[model samples]
Target chain A: MDSENLENINQMLEQDAELREKIKDQVTEFDKKTRVMTGLLNKIHSTPTNQLPALLDSVQPVLYSCSDVTAEIADLVPANQFWRWKDTWCNSLRNAVFVATLIEFLRSESLMTIQQVSDILGIQPSWKDRFVLTAEDYLHGVISLVNELSRLAVNAVTMGDFEQPIKISNFVKDIFAGFSMLNLKNDTLRRRYDSLKYDMKKIEEVVYDVSLRKLAPSTRDA
Target chain B: MAEQPQTGSLKSRTAIVVVFETFRNELDEHNDRRERLIKNSRDVTNLSKKVIFLLHRIMTEDEPTPKPNNDRASRAAAKGREKLKEVQNLFASIRGEVEGDRFWRYQRNVSPGLQEYIEALSFAHYLDTGALISFNQVQQSLSDEHGVPYFPLTLEDYLLGLSDLTGELMRYAISAISQRGGRTIAREVCTFVRSCRADFETLTPYYKELRKKQAVTSQSLQKIEDATYAIAVRTSEYDLPPEMLDDVVAMVSGS
Candidate 1:
C-alpha cells in the first residue's frame, strides 16, 4: 500500500471538515437572527390583531439580516453540493423559512409560495443552484407554519380576539387539505404531515369553542 | 373592530390549492426518483457482494504460491474482473438519475452501493497486484468509455470502501495461510492491513461512520494476527518439513 494514497484521502477529508466548520459558523449566525425574528413574531400572540402589520414591519430588518447570513452560507457551500452539507444547517434554514412564511401569512392572510420564500431569502428556489432552497424545506416550513398557527389560534382567543381564531382555523384547514393531496413517503415530511392533523384538530376545537359560545361576531369574519 | 377581513375567500382558497398542486407534483417526482435510485443502489450492492464472494472463492480455491505472476492468481483476477463488469453496468445504468446536482441530492441513496463497489474493486486489486487501489484508479473504473465519470466519487465513500477492504483481506489471509507459500502472503496482508489502520486513524474524526468501520478493521487485523501467531507457534514446535507440517496441522485443525 502506498502511504501517499492514504495521505491524499486524508487531505480531502480534512478540507471537507474545514468547509463544514465554516458553514456551521454561518449557520449559527443565521440561527441567531431567526431566533430574534421568532421572538418578535411570538409577540403577535399578545398584540391586538390590528397591530400585526406594525409587528410584521418591525421584523423586516432581522429578516433582511437573516437573508444576508444565508447568502454568506451559500458562498461557503461548493457548487452542486448543497445537499451534501444540508443536514448541518437544515433545521436552521427551515426555522428561517418558517419565520418568513409566518410573516407573509400575517401580512397577507394567505400561504407564502416557495418562490416567495426564496425571494425573501435572496436565494434561488430551483435546485440548479447549490444554494437554492429545496421544496422539502419549503414544505417543512409550511408545516411549521401550520403548527404555529394552531398555537396562535388558542392564544388569539385568550387575547379576546375571537375572529382571529376563526381565520386561523379556516387557514389551517385549507393548508391541511392541501397537504392531504401529497403522496408523502415514510420520511420526516410524512411524520410531520401526520402530526399536522392534530394541529388541525386543535384549531378546529378552538373554532368550535368560539362558535359554541357565540363569542365570534360572525363565523365568516376573518 | 374597524373592519374584519376575510381570509379564506373563494379566490384565496383556489390559489392555495393551485400552489399545493404544484408542490404535490414536485414532491411526487422527487419521491419517485429517490425510490428508483434506492432500488438500483440495492441491486448494485447485491451484485458487488457477489463480486466480492466470487473473488474470495477464486483466490481460496487454489493454493497458489506468492509469486505475482502465478497462473491461478491471474485466472482469479480475470474472473473477478468479469464479474465486476456487471456491477459497473448497474452503476452506469443509473448515471443519469444522479447526474450533476442530483447526485449530491441523492448521494445517501447512492453511497451504500458505491462503497460496496469500492470494497469489491479494492479487494480484487489487492489480490491481483498485492497493493492498495488508488482513489483515482477506482474512479477510473467507474468512468465511461469517454473517461467522464458517471458521477464524481466522494472521498468519504472512497475511504469507507477502503476501510471495508481490510476485512476482506483479513478473511483472504486466514483462508490462504495454510496453503503452500500461504504464510508469506498472510504476513504481507497483515502488514498492509496494519498500515491501512494506522493511516485511517488520523481520518476517523472527520467521518463518524468511518470511525465505526475503523473499529471493525481493528478487529479484522486482530484476527489475522492471532491466526498468523498460532501458525508461527505451531511451525516452531514442529520439526518436520513445511509441507508435511502443513498437512499435520490441517489434520489437527480438522480442515
Candidate 2:
C-alpha cells in the first residue's frame, strides 16, 4: 500500500509538470498578442487627432488576433480552473478594452457601450461563450479605459485639442456615474474604481486649465 | 422591403442596447452580492480564528483523571458555538444569492473562511465526542444551523480543513508530552494523522495546493512521531532533564 501511494504521488507530480508547461505555452501566446495590441494602442496615443482613423484601422486586425488568443487561453484551461488563471491574462484583456473605448472616443466622442465593445472584438457579451469574454472582463476593460482616458484628456490639451479634454471629462463623468451604480467585489476592479475619483478630478483640472487659457478647440477649428 | 430591413436593423440595435443594459445590471448585482459575501466570510474567518485559539487554550496538558470539567474550556466552547451560529446566519443571508451560477462567483471569497470554520468546528467536535467528525456530519450540521435544505460545503474545503486540523493536533501532542509524559495521546494522534495522510493521497492528484498541504501534514506527523520516540528513549535512559527539554524538542523537530 505504501508503494502504491508512492507511485500515485509520482504520477501526480509528472502530470502537474505537464499541466504547468501547457498553461505556460498558452499564456505566452496570449501575452504576445496583448503586447502587439498594446504597441498599436501606443501608436494611436501619439498620433495626432486627425490621424487616429488610419491608426484605428491598422489596429483592428490586431484586436481580432487578441480575441482569438484570449479564446485559446480560455480553451487551454479547464473551465473549473479558469479562475486560477484569470489573473494571469487580466492585464491583456484590460488593454483590449482600452482599445475598444479608444475607438469609441475617437469615432463617437462618448463612452463605448459594452455591447459595442463586444461587437468590435467579435466576442460574446455573456459567459455563454465559455471560451470567450464575460461581463466582468468587459467591466475590467472599461475600468482600465477610464484610467487611460484621464491621461488622454491631459495629453489632448498638450496636442492643442483643447475641446478633447472637455469631451473626455463629460464622458468619464458619465462612466463614473455608471460605475457607481454597481457594487464592485473583484479586488482589481475595486482598486481601479477608487482611482477613478482621482481620474475624474484630473480630467476636470485639465478642462479647467484649458478654459483658463481660452484654448478651447472652437476658435482654432473655426 | 428595403424599409422593413432598415427598421429591422434599427430594432436590433435597440435590442443590443437593451441586452447590454440587462448585462450591466446583472454585473452590478453580482458585484454587490460578491462584496457582501466576502465581507461576511472575512468576519467568519476572524471569528473562527478566535474559536481556534479558544480550543487551543482549552486543550489541557495533562488531562485530569476525573476531567475536572474546566470551567474556562466550557465557556470558550460556548463562545465558539455562538460565533459559529453567526457564521451560519451570514451564510443564510447569502444563500438566496448563491443559487445557480452565482455560487462560483462567491466561492473564492468564502472558501478560506469556510475552511477555517470547519477546522474550528471539527476541533470542537473532537473535544466533545472524542472522535473525528465526518464530512457528512459537517454538512448536515451546517444545513441544520442555517435551516437550509442544501449546504454548499465543497469536498475540497473539507479535506483542506482536515489537513489543517492535523497541525493543531501536532501542537496538542507536543503540549501534552511536555506536561506529563503523554505517549498515549501522541500515539493516538500519530494513528489519526497517518490515516488522514492516506486518505489525502487520492485527492492530491486533483488539487495542486492539496499536495503541498499533504506534504506539510506528513511533516507534522513526523514531528509527533520523533517527539514520541525521543520521549520514550529519554524515559528509558534517564529522567528527562527540565533544562534539556528545549534542545530535545528542537532536535526532534529538526530531524
TM-score of chain A, predicted model 1, versus the true chain A, to 2 decimals: 0.92
Residues A41-63, candidate 1: write the lDDT tens digits.
Answer: 98988898889889999998888
The residue pairs in collision within model 1 are: none
The runs of at least 3 residues in candidate 1 whose Cα sits more than 4 Å from the true structure, single-residue gaps closed, are A125-127, A219-222, B1-11, B62-69, B237-255
Q: lDDT of each model, Cα atoms only?
A: 0.83, 0.69
Tens digits of lDDT, candidate 2, B126-150? 5565456776667776775445633
lDDT, candidate 1, B1-255, per-residue tens: 222122332225556666677779998888899889999989989998998998878777744344443566667778888889998898899898988778888998999988998999888888778788998898899999999998889888998999999999998899887576688778888899998998889878778999999999999999999988987897888687766876776779865
lDDT of 2 by residue, A75-112 (tens): 56554444445666666666777777776677776555
Judging by TM-score against the true structure, name the best candidate. 1
Q: Residue B134 in candidate 2 has what lDDT? A: 72
- For lDDT, the strongest prediction is 1
Model 2 regions lying over 4 Å from their true place = A1-23, A79-82, A125-136, A150-163, A180-191, A197-222, B1-28, B31-101, B117-159, B171-185, B191-223, B234-255
Task: Report per-candidate DockQ.
Answer: 0.46, 0.06
